[model samples]
Target: MLIDWFTVAAQALNFLILVWLLKRFLYKPILNALDAREKRIAAELADADAKKAEARQERDEFQRKNEEIDQQRAALLTKSEEDATVERQRLLNEARKESDDLRTKWQEALRSEHQSLSEELTRRTREEVFAIARKTLADLATTNLEEQMTDAFIRRLHKLDSAERGELESAFKAASTPAIVRSTFDLPSAQRSAIEGVVKDVLAIETHVQFETAPDLVSGIELSANGHKVAWSIGNYLASLQKHVDDLLNVPPKAATKAIAPPEQQANG
Candidate 1:
């Protein structure tokens, strides 16, 4: 019931003073520290998040670069393979062309060699044949060869028919112009008479049969009349043989022609 104003006043003042001390020392200081801690934590978390994002970006960039490098390597390998294949084909083609050229050259060489061999063989054969023939003919030209040939020719002339006899008479008459019979040697009396009788009998015409000795006719007879001359002589036969001897011997012209030719002819004067 009694009112104590001073005590009430003093208590009120004490309570206000306590409130000020709490606000200034305990409450204010605790609040300030908590705020500072929260700010520091937020800063630290933001820094960590930024670092993680940077790491992820770096990993993605590295992967992309690696993929690009792989693609470039694959392309280079493929190009190298194609180039190698092309080079191999080119080399093979070149080798084949060279081989073909070599084959053609070898064939040509073989053909030329064969032709040369054939020509040589032909020439040798011909030479051998002609040499054999010449030797055989020379052996047949014995001492009795002239008598045998003359007798045989006369006998063959006797075998002629009437029409052939008339032809022979005309031939002989036309062939005896100067009528001077020449001989290589003096004939026996009996032989001369026999020859005259045969000529008169066969031709049925006779004038005179004259004889002269001449050694140049090589032991054969010659008759000339009109524009014709008939000669049966060894020298003439030999000359005819010499003319074609090169072809018969099958030797080169220079060799065969020089070997058997007359001295004046061989000199080509």
Candidate 2:
């Protein structure tokens, strides 16, 4: 309760000085260290952020590369599938074409074989007919055949016109060499006499006529005139027939198939 101004003033002054000293030494140094530490932490944080951002960008770029690779793989697979489908279709078409060509060739071969068989059959039939005709003719070659042939030849001489008779006489007169006549049968005395009479009537000159038998003549009349032999026979007819066959075979027309009549189906009551 006593008034102490000097002590009070000194105490206040001492307190103010201690406060200033503590502020200068402790507060200022601590504040300065804290500020520097905060600045360093901020710089480190910024650096870390930049590194994270770079890592994120790298990850995005890797993901984008993977997506592009996947797309390219899908495109390649699709293209390969298309190419395989095209190849398969092309092979199928080629096989079908080959089958068609083979079928056509087979049909042509069958047609040719059938035609050849038919022609061979026709040729054999003709040959058989000619053989039978020749066989029958061989059986008819009797002793009386010579007499009949001579009578027939003499009959032809009588039917000759005046112009033919004069030509015969001229031919006989012009012939200095004797001509041998071919025959297929034996000559009889009556036939020879008949032939002599006809020859004398046609030529009006006496001449010696000889006869020969040759089986190769093929049933016909043959005469030699002025070193030229003229013949009319079944063999000549056959030769003409063979010529006609050759002409028919040279240009063959399209084969026409004959229609086969269908069997009638019985009506059910």
- The positional error of residue 177 in candidate 2, measured at the CA in angstroms, is 25
* TM-score of candidate 2 against the unseen true structure: 0.39
Q: How far off is residue 73 in model 2, in Å? A: 3.5
**Candidate 2 lowest-lDDT run of ten:** 254-263
Per-residue accuracy of model 2 over 43-77 as CA lDDT, tens digit each: 99999999999999999999999999999999999
In lDDT terms, how accurate is model 2? 0.68
Q: Candidate 1, residues 1-269: lDDT per residue as tens digits?
A: 48799989998999999999999999999999999999999999998999889999999999999999999999999999999999999999999999988888888888888667755554454344335544565677633433433454346446667886666567667754434445555655654565566556766777466766675455455433344334454445444544465356677787766678899886885
Candidate 1 steric clashes = 0
Mark the regions of model 2 whose C-alpha exceeds 4 Å error after superposition.
1-25, 112-269
lDDT of each: 0.65, 0.68
**Candidate 2 residue pairs in backbone clash:** none
| Candidate 2 positional error at 20, Å | 6.2
